[model samples]
Target chain A: MKIRVLVSLKPGVLDPQGRAVHHALEGLGFKGVDDVRIGRTVELDVADETSDEALTEMCEKLLANTVIENYKIEKLG
Target chain B: MAFRSAVITFPGSNCDRDMAVALEQVSGTAPLRVWHGDAELPEGLDFIALPGGFSYGDYLRSGAMAANSPIMREVIRAADRGVPVLGVCNGFQVLTEARLLPGALMRNASQHFICRTVGLKVENAQSLFTQGYDAGQKIQIPVAHHDGNYFADEETLDRLEGDGRVAFRYTENCNGSRRDIAGVLNKSGNVLGMMPHPERAVDAAHGGTDGIALFEGAMKALASA
Candidate 1:
């Protein structure tokens, strides 16, 4: 099975990189860029028997810091 | 009685020697050098110093790999017994990553590496690590890193500040650390994780000896205890 994990800073956490990107986009004359938030995507290949619980455990344990970031799991056929 | 200290050198640790030297100079006894793979730390260790460096090449996150090293299990055990642990620069990252300390070290807000001496305000004078300095006293310590920005939720931050766990604050805001926190202590006040390199500021000729008091404080307190 193919899995995709999207990890992002929780809302209300200050993201300097995202802010800078927002600024750069506005500078490039791209209007309506209210704000930008950054995140990371990781793709993994795992045994098809891997259940949703295991993937959630992976996110909570190491994929994302629960203290500051949140992660979503996506399974691709 | 002379103090017994140990400096743990994880693979890729560059400041282990400097930390050992600083401890030796202040305590008048050389610190035992321990490697990460070692299963045991020397018995009767009065102090443990986790020095800075690119441990495990910052894989998975700064200090993530090193925090899980064989040595850290021992560190966690030692800390639970109240042995004083000081983690500077990269060592601070390890402590947080290991869950021995709260918060996480995020990339610099400016997305640039910071390197230089910055003024630090001593916030808690009662912790074993900060007893040498007066509360609210500002001192200089050199900081160098790209991932030194500290992040924690507001509730956790309030608890840390309310409980007087914050050890040091950056006066100049060199990094986009929330609330300009430069260092913090564990709830027990026995473990400290600070980004500034106090080991680098112990000599008068090294620009200033602003950081000397921290070492002396540990030695004196442990000697009397």
Candidate 2:
């Protein structure tokens, strides 16, 4: 089984890299861009018996820092 | 008994020698240099330090990889047993990732790597790390990092403040740290994680000796214990 994990800073947390990219877009004459937020994705291949609970535990333990980030796991066929 | 200290060096750690030097200068005994792969730390350690650097090449996230290394299991156990642990800069990131400290270090607000000496206010002088300085005293310490912006929820910040766990505050708000927090102590006050490099400030030849008090403070605390 294969899965993808998306990790992003929480809504209220400041994303400096996202903000900098937004500024660069504006400087390049791109308009109508309200905001930008950056996040990362990690893809993993696990045993077919990998349970959802175990995946969640992986995110909570190391994939995402619960203090400032949130993660979502998606199953990919 | 003499001060038994250890400095754990991750593969990319650059300040381990400096941390060991500072410890030896204050404790009059060289700290054992332990590698990150070592699963067991030497027995009978009174102090442990995690120095700053691009640990694990700052991949994935700052300090994220090193925090889960083999040696950290032992460090966590030592910290839980009330052994004094100091984490500076990248080391601070590792502590947070290891959950030994609260909050996470994000990119600088300006999105630039800041490297310079900054003023810090000793917020809580009750910890073994800060007891050498006067309460509310302002001192100069050097900070150099790209991800030192500390963040924690408002409630956590309030609780840390209410419990007097905040150890140091940046006088100039060098980073976009929540509440201007530069350093924080664990709930038990046995672990300290700070963004500024006190080791860099320990020698007058390094431009200032303001950082000496922290090492001296640890020595004094261990001596009296």
Error of 2 at B163 (Å): 0.6
List of chain B TM-scores, one per candidate? 0.98, 0.99
Q: For candidate 2 chain B, which ten residues in a row score worst on lDDT?
A: B216-225
TM-score of each: 0.93, 0.99
For model 2, how does the per-residue alpha-carbon lDDT over B1-225 read when each residue is reduced to its tens digit?
778999999989999999999988888899999999998999999999999999999988899999999999999999999999999999999999999999999999999999999999999988889999999999999999999999999999999999999999999998899999999999999999999999999888989999999999878888988
Candidate 2 regions with alpha-carbon error over 4 angstroms: none
Q: Let me know the DockQ for model 1.
A: 0.63
Q: After superposition, how far is residue A40 of candidate 1 from its true place, in Å?
A: 1.7
Tens digit of per-residue lDDT, candidate 2, span A1-77: 99999999899999999999999999999999999999999999999999999999999989999898999999996
Docking class of 2: high
Question: What fraction of correct interface contacts does each candidate retain?
Answer: 0.63, 0.84
Error of 1 at B75 (Å): 1.2
